[model samples]
Every structure is written in C-alpha cells, then in structure tokens.
Target: MNAKVRLGEFLLTRRSQLRPEDLGIPDYGERRRVPGLRREELASLAGVSVSYYTRLEQGQSLNASPQVLDAIARALRLEEAERLHLHNLARSSAADPGRRRSPAPERVTEATRQLLEALAHVPAILTGRRSDVLAWNRLGHALFAGHLDPGAPERPAQRPNMARLVFLDAHTRDLYADWPAKARAVVGHLRLVAGRHPDDTALHALVGELSAKSADFASMWADHRVMACTVATYRMRHPLVGPLTVTQQTLSQDPSLGQNIVVATTEADSPARTTLALLDQVTPQHGPARPTVRAGSG
Candidate 1:
C-alpha cells in the first residue's frame, strides 16, 4: 500500500460518489466525463485552489496541513472511519521515503492468553492486523471454525485468517446467513487497516493473495470503502448448533500491535443462547487438547 497512491485513490473514490446537487450546488446538466463533483467543485467546497487540490489528488503534493485535510474530509462527506483513514494516509505519505522499520511481531501476550482462558464460557479469539487468529478459546473454535482443525492457530505457518475464511473457505462461506454483507464489512475494515499500516508488507501480501483468489474480495477491494468493526451482529448457521445470532464485541489491548480480542455473545434466554449452550455441551470443557495453529499465507 503506497501511501501517496492510497491517498490519491481514497480521495478519488470518495469524490466520485458525491453529486453536485448532493452538496447543495446547482447542476447545470453539464455532460461531465466523471461522476460526482469535479476537481474545481471539490476544491471550492474545501476552500482550496483547484490547482492545489489537483496536485494533491495526483500524488504530487505532500505535507498537507491538518486543517486542509479536515476541510477536504468534510467536503467529501467522509464518515468517521473514512476521515481517520484519510488522515492516516496523509500522515503516512509525509513520512520519510527512505525510513524503514521492522514489522511488529504478532504474538498474543501471556496475559491475554490467561484472559482467553478466563473467558471460557464465551466464544472468544484474538486476531492481529491481517485478522489472523493468534489464539482462540475452546468455544470460539467450536462456534466459528469447527470444520477446520481446532489447533490451527497455534501453528504459525497455518494460522486461520478471518477474512480469508469468509471469502475463500467453503465452510466459512456456508456459515454466514448474510455472506455478502459479511464480506463487505471484512473488506471495509481491511481498507481502514491498510491505510493505517501503509508499510505492512505482510498486509500487502495478504491483500494481494485474497485479490488473486477471490473475485468477491477483488470487487470489494476495488470499492475502497473504509470501516472499523467495533461491534457487530451476525447470523450463522452452524452445522452442529443450527441457526444462531451472535453479537461480536472487539476490544483492543495494544494499539501498536493492531490486535483485538473478539468476543461473541447472545441475548439472555434467547434461542441463540440455548444453541450456544448446546454447542458448549458438545465441545470439550477445557481448551483444545493440542496447540496447533494456522497462518493466512500458509
């Protein structure tokens, strides 16, 4: 993810979605080559010169001021996630071109492992930047990826990726009731992560692999949507548990690692809760007997 190119693409994608009338501007019914606001119109709305905005959009400008970026964000009608993504792109673009840093290790802390063990009653898993399952509780494995080997996450070379599973794995695809919506949300969140970690080589590789393998992923990737998955409800058709609705809550333990603890829950005394309890009864009470793991690229 080249930051300059990403910034330009983000701006272009967002700009192409808005129409003149949508921004309270008069439409003279001029035949324009592109949809949405023209460069001059966007610049005017953002309180900037057309030439300057053109330079920015062309990836020829760096060091965009915070005020200018904020103005452009408002002009584009960007949501909170999109606005943050734009700022992240701008910041990454301005970073020294020759500067380099080693990729941060994606490892679950011992403390987090303990927490995962403590939260034994709930379906929970830990995921890193590329949505690779770093670790998972017993119920999480049974609830989400029971078809795959339960010990996959322990093996670095074969770690299961949530996005890849959703888009490429047959079992995962069959698990969701609203597969398209789930796929879109996955791609959207990945866009936000890509903007924030522009230099992540592994992330680039993951995106490239998914784009090559899944037509759905390729299409969604091209959309350039940005989203953050803090909390979401999903309907799943588990082979063992039948239909269940789970509300997933994502919590961050370390910002620098870009890892999250994802825990799934159901409404009290609901059918989904009963189904989850049944699932618990079928699975082992203790954690997986083995510690095998899986990786996204493996």
Candidate 2:
C-alpha cells in the first residue's frame, strides 16, 4: 500500500483499539455508532483540532511534524516500536515518490560468508530485510529448513522467505511447537519493515501475496502490531532430532545493507544442547569443508 493509505490505516486501527476508559476519560451514558475513541476525543487528547486530526486520519494531511506525531503517539499509548513506525510512516507519506531510490538486490558479501564459516558449528542463517534467506551454515540449514533444498538460498529466485515459510509452508509451521507466537512475531516484524520501507515494491508484493493466501497472516497483519526480531526463545520439533529449545538471536550484518545473521543456541550442557550437537553431526557437510567454506544457501 502507499504510505499515506498505510499511515491512515495504522492510525484508524490503533484508534479503534483504545477505549475512553483506557485513558481515564469518563464516559457518559450515550448511544455509540462505532467502537473505541472518536476522532474528536483523540484530537483533544493529542492537543490538535478535530478537523486536522480527521484530515490526517483520512490521508488528506501528510505534513505532520515530528512533535505532532509524537503527541499523537502518546495519546494512542503506542509502544516504542509502534511510535518509531508512526514516525517512519509519516515521513514516507510526505516524501516525494520521484526522489526515492529503488532498493538494490540483496547479497551476502565475502566478509559475511567468512563470518558464517567461522560460526559453522553454530546454527546461523543470514537473512535480508524482507526476511529472505541469503545464506546459512550447515547446522543452520538443518535446524531451520532441512525439508527444502539445502542450496536454495544460493539462487535469488529460489530463496525462501521466513514469513512465507512460517505461514504457508507446512514443514515450517510444524517446526514451531508454539506456532501462533512465531506467526505473530513474523507478522509484527514484517509490519515494522513495511513502515520503514514504504517504497519497497518487492516487500509490498510479498505482503500482498501472503495476505491473499493465508487467513492467519491477513488477521495478524490487520492488527497493526510492530516488533523487533532481536532475540526470541522457541521450542522446535525437528523432524530428525526431535524436540529442542533454543534461543534465536539476530545480529545485524550491516544497517545500510539491511542484512542480519540469526544464530540459534541452546543452554549449556542441557539435553537441548546435546540434541543440537547430534543434529550438527548428522547434517551433511555441504560444499568444501567448513572453516575454509564454500558458497551455499539456507
């Protein structure tokens, strides 16, 4: 969606989620036409006129100042991530489309490949901003996507998107013991990315495709939640190695490149750790021997 429309929808959705009682506003007995706070109520709370806030919410006003956006965010009780997203949307909505640069095709640099090789014993997958699998080490491939072709990430056209896998691929869906939590995290992070890169055609296309194909994804997307996929603990039901708990931590490779390295680790000397070690041993060594590495996929 365009930045203006996205900003409007986000504002409307968040407005609908709050009640007058949520912010200590006394409600008199009266018939209501819709849910949550009205535009007048929100405008009053944000210290703006109703007409201005209405214009903003209707996508007619795109030049909101940072102070005004911050005020609106405070009135809506937005979290840190959601507040950042609000500012991003507002900026994009005001930006000239002709001046925006098209995103470059994402690639894993040699330096990144060397880092992956250094973490060969650990489960590590490199992913792009839109959650596309750029590359992975042996254990990383086995832990996350052993069902798919091990070399799929080597080809851009064949790269697996983490969001798509979580919602649309049965194997990935089954891998997570608490599937709903994983699904929400993926959607939330995707929402944040969408706000940040409003001009990203491929990213928007992926969102549209997933929304059309999966009811679950559509519902989650409509919720307008935002999250950073920094560190999360998940229980995985690996087909070969059975159940194991691991903490997945995402490390940014480069902010300008919009690539991140996701590493999965288990607790020290735990059964999960032993299971991971077993998985490492059983996972075939692809290409050249690790530590000296060869090009591969996730």
State each model's CA lDDT, in order.
Answer: 0.90, 0.91
For candidate 1, the per-residue lDDT at 69 reads 94
Q: Candidate 1: which stretches are off by over 4 Å?
A: 289-298
Residue lDDT tens for model 1, 19-128: 88888998776787888889999999999999999999999999999999999999999988888999999999889968868676788788999998898889999999
Query: Model 1, residue 204: displacement in angstroms?
Result: 0.2
lDDT of 2 at 134: 92
Worst 10 residues of 2 by lDDT: 286-295
Write one digit per residue (lDDT tens) for candidate 2, span 89-180: 99999998889998999987889988988998899999999999999988888999998887789888989999999999999999999999
Q: Which stretch of 10 consecutive residues in model 1 shows the poorest summed lDDT? A: 289-298
Per-candidate TM-scores read: 0.95, 0.93
Best by TM-score: 1
Q: What TM value does model 1 have?
A: 0.95
